[model samples]
Structures are given as structure tokens and as C-alpha cells.
Target: MRFLIDFFPILLFVAAYKLQDIYTATAVLMAATVLQTGIIYGIDRKLQTMQKVTLVLVLVFGVLTLVLQDERFIKWKPTVLYASMGIVLGAALWGWKKNFLQILLGSQLTLPTAVWGRLTVIWVGYFLFMAAINGYVAAYYSTEDWVNFKLWGYIFPVVFIIGQGLYIARYIKDDSNGAEKS
Candidate 1:
């Protein structure tokens, strides 16, 4: 459910492109994103920080898509968002509040500080690379190619990152039982 909630905008954007005209799709996506954010806040009884960022970005990029009548802006939205996250994570890894990534992901797993810093740096580099690729594809490649790359390019890196995280999690032995056995 949380995953679906987080993915609501991306799924909506893809569906909007498939179901109707681009402008109409943009409108539908904006509505769906707002509704999804609202639903999350309603259920949790508190607003999430990411909800605000997602809502603002969706609205801005959706409008950019409609007003400029170019899908390129919409395509670049994720790149911008990811790059922003990368910057913040990179700063955190540099010792400016090391808890940043942990706060975002700690519910799922715990890791040593070195692992967290390494993961953060990897994410930072991934975001930087993704931004450059997005710019190149949007500028030089065909629209169809850009869209295809946008969809497919994201999958492999995400899968690889998750796999690496899982491997790290496995090596993070449980400490709770040590005291009991001692």
C-alpha cells in the first residue's frame, strides 16, 4: 500500500499518456497526484514531507508539459528530482547530518555507518549519471527513444541498488541475540 501510494504519480503519468491526450493526461495526473497525497495524509493524520515535494513537482511539471506542449519538460522532472535527492544524500555522506538517509530508509533495514555512507554515495552518483543521460536523450534522441529509455533505464539501476542493499542487510548480523547468549 505504501509502495502504491508512493508510485501513484508515476503510474498515473504513464496511464494518462496511454488513455487520453497529453494535456488531458496531464490534468488527470495532477488530479490523481493531489488525491493520492490527500489520501495519504488523511489515513496517516499527518502530512508527509515527501508528499509536499511530490505534489509541488507534479503540479509544476504537469503544467510545464501543458503550457510548453512538450513532453521533454515532463520527462526531465524525474531527473531533477533524483538529482536533488542525490545532492542531499551526498551532503549527508560528507558528515552533514548522517541520519538523513537512515531516516528515510531505516524502517526497512539497519546498516553500519560505513555501509550507509557507501550507499548514499552510490545513490548520489546514480542520480548524477541519470541527470546527464536524461539531458542527452531528451536533446538528441527521438521522442520515442527518450520515453523508452526513461522507462527502462530507471528499472535496472533501481533493481541493482535494491539487490546491493539486500546483500548489505544480510551481512548486518543481528545484535539483539548477543547479549542474551552472553
Candidate 2:
């Protein structure tokens, strides 16, 4: 349910693009994001930071794409978002000596400090890689291609998550004993 709600904007954007054009798609995306955020807030009574960021960026860039009659702004939004995430994660791990992934999810998933550090590095690298991929596709590809890339690009995250889950499965503790199996 929540996944569909969150993805409503992207789905709408793609549909609008197919039906009309980029400017129309941008407007639909902007409106859909606003509505999604509002609906989430009404249901949950709170908004995640990323939800807010998505709303703001969609509005800002979507409007730019509509008002200026250029699709570049909307195309660049994902790259900017991915780069910001990478910078923040890298700074927290390297500069502050903090494993943010552990800080955020430590209670749910217990692991050695080394594993947490490695997970952090993996996340940072993934974000950087995604940012580069988005930038490259947006800069060099046609609008149709970029839209197609956005749809297909979801696979990268799915693969990353599955791969990470597999990697961490070996580290999970034995449920009966509450001790990690060696």
C-alpha cells in the first residue's frame, strides 16, 4: 500500500509522458508528489526527511521544467539527490568516524563494528555509482531514453538490496541461541 502510494508520482509521470509530453509529465509529477506527501502525512502524521526532500525537489525542478520549457532541471533531480546522499554518508563515515547505517539500524540488526563500517562503505559507493549513472544518462541520452532509464534504473536498487541482504544473512544470529553462528 505504502509502496504504491510512494510510487504514485513516478507512475503518473510515466503515464503522462506517454500520453502527452515532458512538460505535462512534469506538472503531473509535481502535483502527484504534493498529493502523496499530504496523504502520507494525513495517514502517518509524520513525514520522513526524504519524503520532504522529494516533494521540494519535485516542485522546484518540475516548475523549472514547466516554466522554462526545459526538461534538464527535472532530469538532474535524481543525480543531485544521489550525490547529496553519498556526500553525507561519506562524510559521516570518514570525517566523523561514525557508522550512520549502524546508528540508524543497529538495534534491529546486530553485527560486528567491522560489518557496519563495510555496510556504510557499500551504501556510499552505491549512491555515488547511482549518481554517476543518472548524470551520464541524463546528459547523453534523449528525453525518451532518460525516462526509460528511470523505469529500468529501479532494478539497480533492487539488485543492491538483494545482494546486501544475502551478504548480511551469514552474520545473523541463531534465533534459538541468540548467538552468531560461526
Candidate 3:
């Protein structure tokens, strides 16, 4: 559903890369991301901030990759995106004295204020770690290696998200018992 839709562009990019070349894959990724955003907007009538940022970065970096005939542009995209998210989260938490992650998800997940703060810290660390890894792989590795990492690196986020779910499970209110439980 939403997960597939969000990943639609990356999936298409990978398939196109396998079928053709980097330029072709870049074009496909750009088009697919635009289409994905359009479909989301048509249904929701609004795009999340992160979605909009991703769309813009895909278009900008994708076009640069095509225009400059350099794969570096495309390869650097993930690092830029991850770094931006990390910066925003860290800034919100420290500079603004706010936890934007908690603010964003507070409506859906009810937790003690302390839990929310800790969750925000966890997300900030996760994002920073991802950013660092992306930067490292993009800089020190070959284009082929970076592309391979793009596919395999998804495992990190998946594992992190599952860990978050497990950590939050204990905090979620139980409807059956009408109380929180460990």
C-alpha cells in the first residue's frame, strides 16, 4: 500500500538500471517519483513535507545526473536527503526546544512525554547514522557499489523501524485490558 507507493520510484529506478543504464534509470526514477506524488496528492489532497522534499530532490538531482552526465549527482542524493532529515530533527529537538518527530506522530501514538522525547532522540540518532553511512558509501565506493548499497541499505531502515515498533509496543495502550502493559 503506502509503503510500496513511497518506494515506487526507487524500485523502478533499480529495475530500469538493471534493464538499461544510469541515465535511463535516472529518468525513470524522476518520472516515477512525480507520478507517485501525483497519485498521493490526488488521493490525499496534500503531500507530507518529507514527500515534497523527496520529490524535489529526485527531480533536481536526477536532472543534474542526466545533464552533467555524472553519476555522482544521483549517488549523492540519498546522503543529502538523510543528512537534511537528521539536521532538521536535531535542530528541532535542540535549537527550538521541540521534538518534531514526536509532534508529527503524537496524534497517532500516545505515550508519556518522557517516552516521546526518548523516541525523538532515537530517531535523530538513526537518521544521523544513516546519513553517515550513505555519505561513506557514496564517497569511497564505485558507482556500481553505491547503487548496490542503495538496494541493500534499505535493510538498515527496515530493521530500525521494526526495532522502533518493538520498543513502542510496550507503551501502546491495550484495548482488551484498557491499560498499558509490558
**Largest TM-score belongs to which candidate?**
3
lDDT of 3 by residue, 1-182 (tens): 88888777878888889889899999999999999999999989999888899999999999999999999899889888988998998899889999888888888888988898888889888988888998899899987777778888889988998999999999998777655543
- 1-182: candidate 1 lDDT, tens digit per residue: 77677666666656666677557767877899899988888898977565787688879998999898987777677678767777777877675767576778777777877777777777778778877878788789876576567556758576867877786876577878997899
- Clash count for candidate 2 is 0
Clashing residue pairs, backbone N/CA/C < 3 A, model 3:
none
For residue 132, model 3's alpha carbon misses the true position, in angstroms, by 1.2
Error of 2 at 64 (Å): 1.9
TM-score, one value per model: 0.76, 0.87, 0.92
Highest lDDT against the true fold, candidate: 2
- Clash numbers, per candidate: 0, 0, 0
Stretches > 4 Å off in candidate 1: 46-48, 95-99, 106-108, 175-182
- Over 89-109, each residue of candidate 2 has an lDDT whose tens digit, in order, gives 899999999877888789899
Off by over 4 Å in 2: 174-182
Tell me the lDDT of candidate 1. 0.75
Candidate with better TM-score, 1 vs 3: 3
The segments of candidate 3 whose C-alpha lies over 4 angstroms from its true place after superposition are: 176-182
Using alpha carbons, what is the TM-score of model 1? 0.76
Model 1: how far is 47 from its true place, Å? 5.0
